[model samples]
Target: MDVTQSTAGDVIEVRPMTIHIGAELFGVDLAGSLTDEQVAAIRRALLRWKVVFFRDQALDHEAHVRLARHFGAPTPAHIVFGTNESHPEVYSIAKHRTAQNGRTSATRCWSGWHTDITAAINPPWASILRGVTVPPYGGDTQWTNLALAFARLSTPMQRFVEGLRAVHRFDAPAGDGDYARRVGARDLAAEHPLVTMHPETGEKVLYVSPGFVKEIVGLEPSESRALLENLWEHAVSTEFTVRFRWAPGSVAFWDNRATAHLAPVDIFATDFERQFYRVTLNGEVPVGVDGRPSTLLSGEPIEAQPA
Candidate 1:
């Protein structure tokens, strides 16, 4: 699948990475400033593909921030993890060593499937990540199209979930290992619809994930757990996903509202260093098919501002 033309007349070559999720973009240099036509074309591709990849652009922190601004205002690094020293909007994901035994840790704390910042009332609309020090062999990231995930479910299941809502909390569950420790005491939570309508494309998306959703709002505890587990399993089926291997200078810009991504744990076991910089774009509050909006349980709203 490919999109070769845009209303702005800039020809962007989009090569589909998978039938369900991702596309690789060509004919645009992200390191330099982009024209309005190119930016429009890229945004169109992102809505169609859910996630888009670019290779060999070699964007530095400044260039990365500038590229993200073409789509939407970039949010601050993160309320918990903080920002890079020079760039306030850039969040560094550099993990070179583990504190225990001074050896490379065998497990990565972020190796779960999640949409970025779902604990917030309005999660990020998009996330742009640039590979700065990727390992040669491992650390591929996988994304599944949430819209596709919803579309594939049975009609009965779809009807049952479209009107429901779930709680998303930032605290990692017990025995989740390094992830739990790293997330210490952030205390963020929110309630979002089980099926969210895309603010731009009007597509319905499966909005639950194992990483953040704690319970279905109106169900009994046991029933909620069973139902959530079933939905989680269906959401990540391989048929709906695309895996992108990383290389130095490679970039992935994804629609957080329409997909969930997983960072593999294999890279931590290897001796190679893995680092990346991420910038999230501001998003509007999610609304259900019934027209109810997501409610914040705790935490302030994200302030959208250009980098």
Candidate 2:
């Protein structure tokens, strides 16, 4: 649905995506920025559609950072794990020219499909990324519907997963590597429910990923890994995937709870660096779909089912 009413000089285009997941709000100069009403409408659209895209829209770093605040408070990234040093809110994700100690290349490879920091004591709710570098041919990012992932599971699968719990450790499965090489940041592994419900939408979403997931509760490591791997494979199935090619000034924002995204660093040691500024919305702890309270094996608080 295109909103047609506009001043002659202010006319802008809104291109909603053909699929159910994305939309490109074009023509409007975000410089004037969206009005409160327009911003609210954009938010409503984002909720209805999981992700929103804007093409040929440009905003400086300050402007970009400011725009994200419209959604929620911005979380300044912790430096050791953070990408950008200049702007705390912005992360420089390029791999080249980094000092050997920086491990920039290793950090840049996080392009795999994952929601941000589900392992954190309090994970982020959403993230907005501005596309500054567009790959000539192959680099593109794909996000899958985890909310839909949980919904699409067979009833038995859903029931089975619902009863299970997972531990998302800051542990990196860096096979045959030293512990420091595995996860350089402060160790941050914690147990979480397998099936998480979105706090805002109240809908269930699959919450496991390869990045930080450590183990499943109740099951032995072997059985847990097998079951989780099975579910992770299901989460990335073709039917739920949405791919996007980047253009300069293009932007994307998505609900971190219900989606898993993979950024293919398709460009080999080429000079291309997919630079962007990302701002995260702070989030609370998560709860599973089955309404069982989430509990920490240690001191962290899991949710308790309501009366």
Candidate 3:
């Protein structure tokens, strides 16, 4: 399908990167000022593509924050990580600094498939990441369209999951070892419906991820494990994904409500450093298609902290 749109007489060309998930936008420089019409068109492209990419336009911290503010309010740096000293809104996802005492932190690689901060009562609406330093090879990230993943399920399976809710926690599940210790050690946990309705587009999205979702609520231990494993597998099927290779100055902006992403671990194997600055837009509490809103099992609501 043709997804490109033009606004304010400045044609915005949106080139689809894959059948289901991503698009590369041309004719707009993120480092410069954007017209209101251009911003609207970019929002439209985001709804259509799930994630949008930009290449070659170098952006500093200020430029990055400006770019994000054009679309939505930027939240404070991530709840867990430290933010840039000057730009408090931007989270630094650098490989070297994430480690402790010379040993890599469990969160360092972050190679698993997952959504951003689902353990919070309100996850971020979107995430804008700009590559500050990219490796020469093997640090590509991937995103999957959760709406598409939901649509591909059989009628009965869809119905089954629609009524289900799952618990997402920061603690690691059994057998995760150091990785779990790193991620799950945080004091965060929440319950959200398995099928969430996009607040803006009203589309049904498969919301479970192996990274945060620990178990299906109200199910037997064995049943929950088996079912979650199956859902996780289906949600990340290759047919529903798009992969993007990063380079210095490259940017990826995605709707966190409708997608899940995988961070690359291959970059850690080499001496090359991979660094990015991320800014997230505060999101509302998710509502399921069944009309029930997500419930907080442990943590407090995610409040908007002015950038």
Candidate 4:
């Protein structure tokens, strides 16, 4: 697709990647402090596009966290992973060198599409990820706009889901070794509406995804499984999705409340390495259309302090 750039009063140049869901912003240095107007412009683009990309940004761990604070408080790097001791809010997403050396043959283990930390009572409001060691080819991530996904469903289907709630839990892949063990220790879980009103934009989001949502509340096991399967399929349909190819120095900022993202499955097929660092903004409890908040099933809310 041809990227179309437009300037809005010298705030920033927005190069929309598609008719919906994704855009690339130009003329901002993520490494430096942002003026109030710059911050507001970035936030407005994020809410409208669901995800925005920046190319050739020179962002270190501290700069990454600093940029996040302009929009909201930064959450702990991750619930189960170790972060840099000095920069506790910067989470690394790199493959271990030891694991790389040991693997002569590879098996695909997809993380599946998910919003950031939905198992928490307050899932992250936004996430900023910067590419570090990008592969020469492949390892492209994709995101689906849940608000648009919900809007495209039949009227009756939308109404039926609006009243529903689902259970979300951080399910670590079994036999994944250390990472799995830590996630097992945490065992975070929550019950959230299948559809929630975006806290800032007031749009309804179809909140279920294969990564975290476990089952629909108050349904028979078989019935819940079948229903969830159907919803997951529709929520990630191509019409509501946008794919991004990553390069070193590229960064993506996304609204976690209104989107679910797929990690690069093709990376497993290549010997080339991929790595990234991310900081997530603390989120408010999601409210359903009926005006109810999500219920915590297990674990405490993620701890975060302003950056």
Candidate 5:
């Protein structure tokens, strides 16, 4: 299934998922990419695929930021203080991505399943990831379709979680007792609705961040614990997921509102330098299927509009 490019410049061959997913667009240039219509078409395919992989398109930092802006508002850098100072929108996810690592704050070892920023009142709308340094045969990133995940949930389970809320906290005290020591003590935590509709697309999506979700709303301690554990088990199931193998100059973009991702830890050896800049798209207030305002979550809530 070939997707036609917008203009007469170049005909991009979109190999539409004979293998897997919506489409892999070929012959599209990344440096000065496609026209607005072409970009919109790709965006439509991205929403359909849940994740889109662009193989071998090279992009510099400026170009990277430019591509990110095409989607919407630029997301503030992930709150890793030392690493992401140069670009207001781009952030460092690894230990060394920051300018200063001497006093590195502890981050959680994210081996489990999760979304990027569910703790925020309104998490990111989308994410475009570039693999700067990939390992020989591993270090792939897996994305789970939360929209589908929600749609496919057993009716009983869906009803059980329908009106429930969850506590999302970033300042969940990073230490020996916590899940991992790499993430530092979070200074902010907040509550958010469990099920929300994407503000733009209005699709129902599961809204939970694995690392930040502390408890479920209106449930007792034990019930909340059991519910969280159960929902997590449901969220990480393999049937609703896909893993993308990365290559140099390759990038993947997905709607964070409707997806959850897990990054492989294979590239961490003694001498490996794994660094990538991340910028989230500013998200609108999420609404539920019923069209009510969803609760604002996150200890460090960013302003609704761009700062």
Candidate 6:
């Protein structure tokens, strides 16, 4: 359904892309300061829709950080990927730059479905990704509502997952001995619930991230793999997902707590250039259905100062 709300005499258009997961929000400018009412409305839409897209936004590094501050504290760019030099909070997802630098290795961490930085004790609460340059075709990003995915599971399946936990790790790139050693020293691994409760909306989220999640805690490796495979297959079903074709000046803001997103694989097959900038918001430690919080297995949390 299309929702248009008039707040402070400004019409903010919220056009739902699907019954669940994604929406296109119009009428708000991210390059400038936002009013309290506008921020609140946007946050409400984010919680309800899981992810929101904005078209034709003009946001530089400073403006991107400033806009993200309205919702939550902006964390550093990434633990592994690092951030933009001048703007410490802005992480560039520059494909051309990485390709030029020969950083693309056998490890395909960023190419799979994941919630940002699950290896940390406190994963990001939300993420805002703005497209700087986009390809003409076949570089669409996709998101799935984990809450909805969990809701559709059988009652017995829900009960089993609620009591289970899994370890998430940032796999280091292959063939880089020194870099791999550094990553191994940091040991970016954390155990989080297979099912976690959303801190804001209080909805149950299927917290298995196929990219970072390694194995289920307290289970045999085979059993863990099998269970995780089933969960991953179910979580990414087409009905629970929404795909967004990106363009320059497009921005996607999503709640990291209740969603997992797939980065474009088709982009690598083409010679087209694609680049984007992302800023993540600080998130609390995930709490399971039994009211227990996730435990840090190795790495420190990616903490962010107050916005």
lDDT tens digits by residue: candidate 4, 227-293: 8878888988888899999999999999999999987757777788888888899898999999999
Please estimate how well model 3 matches the true structure, expressed as its whole-model Cα lDDT.
0.82
lDDT score at residue 51, model 3, on the 0-100 scale: 98
How many clashing pairs in candidate 6?
Answer: 0
Decide which is better by lDDT, 2 or 6.
6
User: In order, how many clashes per candidate?
Assistant: 0, 3, 2, 0, 11, 0
Q: Report the number of backbone clashes for model 2.
A: 3
> What is the clash tally of candidate 4?
0
Ten residues in a row with the worst lDDT in model 6? Answer: 99-108
Q: Could you give candidate 5's per-residue lDDT for residues 236-300 as a string of tens digits?
A: 67777787777778878778878788766556544555555566777765666566655654346
Ordered from best to worst lDDT, the candidate numbers read: 6, 4, 1, 3, 2, 5
Residue 16 of model 1, lDDT score: 90
lDDT of 2 by residue, 116-213 (tens): 76666566777788777776666677887788888889998888887778876554434434434535444565677888878878888788755656
Comparing candidate 4 with candidate 6, which one achieves the higher lDDT? Answer: 6
lDDT of 6 by residue, 1-307 (tens): 3634444544577889998879999889989889987888889889989999999999998999999998889888776656556888888887754422322232233337888889898999999999998999988999999999999999999999999999888666556565564565567888999999998899999998777888899999889878888898899999999999999999999999999998887788889999888999988999999999999988788889544
Q: How good is model 6 by TM-score?
A: 0.92
lDDT tens per residue, model 3, 57-160: 87888898899989878777876544556888888888765421122233222327778889888998999999988898888999999999999999999999
- Candidate 1 lDDT over 1-307, as tens digits, reads 3634344486678889887789998989999878888888889899999999999987988899889888889998886556545888888887542212111121123227788889889999999999999888888999999999999999999999998999987764455455455555466789999999999999999998557787899999999978887888888899999999999999999999999998677766878888888989989999999999999998788887544
* Model 1 weakest 10-residue run by lDDT: 98-107
What TM-score, computed on C-alpha atoms, does each candidate reach? Answer: 0.90, 0.81, 0.90, 0.91, 0.82, 0.92
Q: Could you tell which candidate, 5 or 6, scores higher by lDDT?
A: 6
Better candidate number, 3 or 4, judged by lDDT: 4
